[model samples]
Target chain A: MSTNREIHLASRPQGWPTAENFRLVETEVPTPGAGQIVVRNRFMSVDPYMRGRMNDVKSYVPPFALDAPLDGGAIGEVVASEAEGFKPGDTVLHGLGWREYALLDARAARAVDPSLAPVSAYLSVLGMTGLTAYAGLLDVAEMKPGETVFVSGAAGAVGSMVGQIAKLRGAARVVGSAGSAAKVERLKALGFDAAFDYHDGPVYEQLKAAAPDGVDVYFDNVGSDHLEAAIGAMNLHGRAAICGMIAQYNSTEPPAAPRNLALVIGKRLTLRGFLVGDHGHLREQFVQEMAGWLRDDKISYDETVVEGIENAPQAFLGVLRGENLGKMLVRV
Target chain B: MSTNREIHLASRPQGWPTAENFRLVETEVPTPGAGQIVVRNRFMSVDPYMRGRMNDVKSYVPPFALDAPLDGGAIGEVVASEAEGFKPGDTVLHGLGWREYALLDARAARAVDPSLAPVSAYLSVLGMTGLTAYAGLLDVAEMKPGETVFVSGAAGAVGSMVGQIAKLRGAARVVGSAGSAAKVERLKALGFDAAFDYHDGPVYEQLKAAAPDGVDVYFDNVGSDHLEAAIGAMNLHGRAAICGMIAQYNSTEPPAAPRNLALVIGKRLTLRGFLVGDHGHLREQFVQEMAGWLRDDKISYDETVVEGIENAPQAFLGVLRGENLGKMLVRV
Candidate 1:
């Protein structure tokens, strides 16, 4: 008999979640039955949205079940397979729990090649996160060539991809906003024509400094204040794709948006809220395009890796606070 | 030579425009040229949108020429025609200014069937304003049958049509918000299941009281506070079609949205801003459908006419303040 280690939801958080909300426990490792495969975790994602899943409420996706393993994006190797699609020694990615090993359906497991890209990339640039940036930027934002594109949370996983993708799509200018000076510089190095440290002052000053002509399209990852700033900077007939609101997610007090909703009319702009799953049909197309870009060295990625599964709760908390530069991952 | 009594833009206003901003001037009536017709004004429209025209900066349409005839939607009688299609005493509709007489291109005039619909009705119900309400509600909002629709400025011209159209399309429940108790009652009489006066404390409170289960779609005419209220009351996957922002037009101070924009992601709503001319391709389709609805009594319309061309500015100010119920017009 082998031991299966898992992290379960110890409690629901009110504001910012504490480590006390998560519990690590050991269980008996059962054999995989028909149509099931066993995966030994290698890498796991600690994303901003994971904080939302821990709450017991309605959202785009269902909340994490109480007294159960908290599932998230994980890359692993098929240790055993009793299903047609997967075999032992094959590398895979799936929505698996915070555990050392997991029993999953063959359909849930996608066998990925290690030759084309690094294996951990499945948790980021080549995975669900990348697909989100692609669909929201291209399909939703309707980003046209030569238009200026601005992104919030510029140094984070999704925002980093959003800026780079906008540049690759031939945007005349690409601007990004991040929390730290280091992250801002990092974003500029990743092809963002201009990047601002939002913490230093009001976003209006930073944005004006970066994009004087105003932005034609804005991909918002950090909501609240960022949305207000984007509105001030959108040009006539501009488009804003609402992606995430990490800044306001932890606020128990009602959110505050400084007046600028009227900008929608003065500018004749279109503000659209979107979900990544709504664009799942674009996944194959995204993979093809992203693969070509990666092969040509036209795209690059960064990851902030935590060493162990036991530190996942802390890693997730850090992601929400902008503590990681790039995709936050845990090496299990 | 006959005198052409005209209303001209005398000055730009700071807030809540007054008579000082408009001037009625008298000039010689021009004789028609080879392809032109002399149009005698019969009916003119005074809409809330004209407020935007009063500003100095450019918008969807250029600002009204200062100290010149402020021309817009009007129905007139062709007193003289040197063109093939038009005849003497031909009842036509054109952008003939707020004047007793004027010369215009015959091609710019469209013959009006006053026998089918009243001449003033053509200026409101079958005019640009009607088409705007219809297109925004049906096309941009993409309103589905049996969905709940909430309209702001429900007793106003476009709002009235929006509610009726949603009802005609089999809406589940239609709620509205007006500025007065009389207007609230008028909305109920016009088939709105529920309505409240916006002056009754916070709009969010009144909105929630009216739509307890939450709103599926919102037709926004008055932006800022009303918009934030609607955003707070929307259900999951809701849609908001922004037709106008009458509330913010005359404000001397910049209005800030106190409502948090993050609610957009929480509810996954879509808010789109549109102009009627942008959807010009639907003109023929609109005429056929709106005409049929009128003949079958499937729809009804209302109007508030302020006599004399000089009072156009007053009527426009009244329309913006929600003092006029239904479509505001100036009969010259």
Candidate 2:
């Protein structure tokens, strides 16, 4: 047995989660049982979705159990194994995050080739984050070739990938909205045809100026004003894939829905909400396509790596505050 | 030429429309030009959608021209024909209402057999109203055989047909909400498994009591409280066909959107807004199936016919106020 440090949900958050809601504790790392492997986690992800999990309400994912280790996407090196095809030093991806080490069933962990790309990518562009952008754009929104695409939270993990994927797929115009002028410049550098800082003016005015002809598809991560603006700027038969509403996740009061939603009737718009867990069937296809794109230099990714498991809470809070320019992760 | 009395838009209404917004004027009915027929209208439909046309804003149909005769669904007998397919004494359906006579292009009119069903049925159950219910449920909502269906405006023409169609297509349960207690009982009489008066109590509590297992499809006609309530009681993968929002149509202020819209993510809900005009491809199939259902007594219909063209404006206002039980029509 060995000692490991892990973060636990000390209490459910009422509004914006605070560091007090999390507790870092040292515990014994159990030896591998039959069909189990022990892993020393190298990287763990902190995402906007985690804020929803901290609430005690039932959602697509269950709330983090009080005083228990909170789990999410993690990449690690296998230290010991008791199952067939067992090997030490094999890098694996699993759902055992916010921890220094994890004892996981072999079925829960999948081996990833470190030589294909950096192992940390397994927790980001090569993992659930990448798959979300792919499935959401191609399937949920049903993006078509040469159609215009608009994305909110363009500097974040899913939004950045959405804009790039849309571009690579032959989108005519790619427009993105971010919180700051710096993020807007970063989006332009990332190949977005048009980018705007939502802080510069009203989102509706900014979006109207960015997409004068209206957008065909809107990939929404930040809801509220962004969603309302998208609804106003959508073309006939436009589609909106509601991936995340990070803007309203921490609000104690129920956020008002878009007042212009009635415009959906006149425009024949479709707004659908989705979670990535329901789309595991697309993983193999996403991995194959994304690998080709990365090898051809058609896509790029960035990560803001916080140093330790103890800082996971702060990293997650940083994601909500728009402090991260791309995927936010903790280097455990 | 013959003298004809027609209804015209005198002025646009600011909030709820009043009789003063309409003008009844006498004009010369034009002689049939080449490929045109002069029809003496028998019945004119006063539908909720017409109220939208009273506004000058662009929509699926152009706004009713100010100080000119308003046009809508009408059934009439051809008095003079200069077209190949039409002749004198033939009953036809055309888009020229609020007038005693109309000069219509033969191609714009469809022959209706009064011997098979009431000629007015062409303007109600056998026409656009039926098509709206059919395509909205099967195509827009993508309803399955055993899912629960919830409809608002259940006592209205489209809503009544929607509930009946869902039941006939093997819905596990059919629930509806209307404005009056009598309308609730009428919905139950029309094969709706459960019905409620939205005015009796909070819509959420009533819908929850009516459908304990939750609704899988919501055919929304009355938006606002009903839509919000349906969202709350919807199951995973639920779909809402936004056919109309009678509740908010006349409101000067924008109605608040559903407060719990974030639930859309966890529930995987799809909300699509559609107009019946876009679903014309389903007309042949809808007419065939609905004709069979009507012939077999599997479906039924009702109408509140106002006596004359002079009462048409009042009948239209009645539709907005939820005063009509089913289809509201004006007889010439």
Residue B200 CA error for candidate 2 (Å)? 1.3
Candidate 2 has a DockQ of 0.79
**Considering every candidate listed, which one attains the maximal lDDT?**
2
Where does candidate 2 chain B have its weakest 10-residue lDDT segment? B52-61
The Cα error of candidate 2 at residue A163, in Å, is 0.7
Please, what are the lDDT tens digits per residue for candidate 2 over residues B1-332? 46899999999998899999999999997799999999999999888877787888877678888999998899999999999988899999999999999998899999988898898899889999999999999999999999999999999999999999999999999999999989998998999999999889999999999999999999999888898999999999999999999998899997885878888888989999999999999999999999999889999998999999988899999999999988988998
Cα lDDT tens digits, model 1, B1-332, are: 57779988899887888989999899998899999999888888877778888989756678988899887888888888899999888899888657888688888989988788888878777888789888988888889998999999999999999999899988899999999999998998889989999998899998898888889899999988898899888988898999888888898876766456766765778888887878888888888889999999988788988988778878877887788889888888
| lDDT of candidate 1 over A125-174, digit per residue (tens) | 99988998999899989999999999999899999999999999889999
Candidate 2 per-residue lDDT, tens place, A32-55, comes to 999999889999988898888888
Error of 1 at A69 (Å): 4.9
TM-score between candidate 1 and the true structure? 0.88
**A108, model 1: CA deviation in Å?**
4.0
Backbone clash pairs for candidate 1 read A259-B256, A259-B257
Candidate 1 scores a chain A TM-score of 0.97
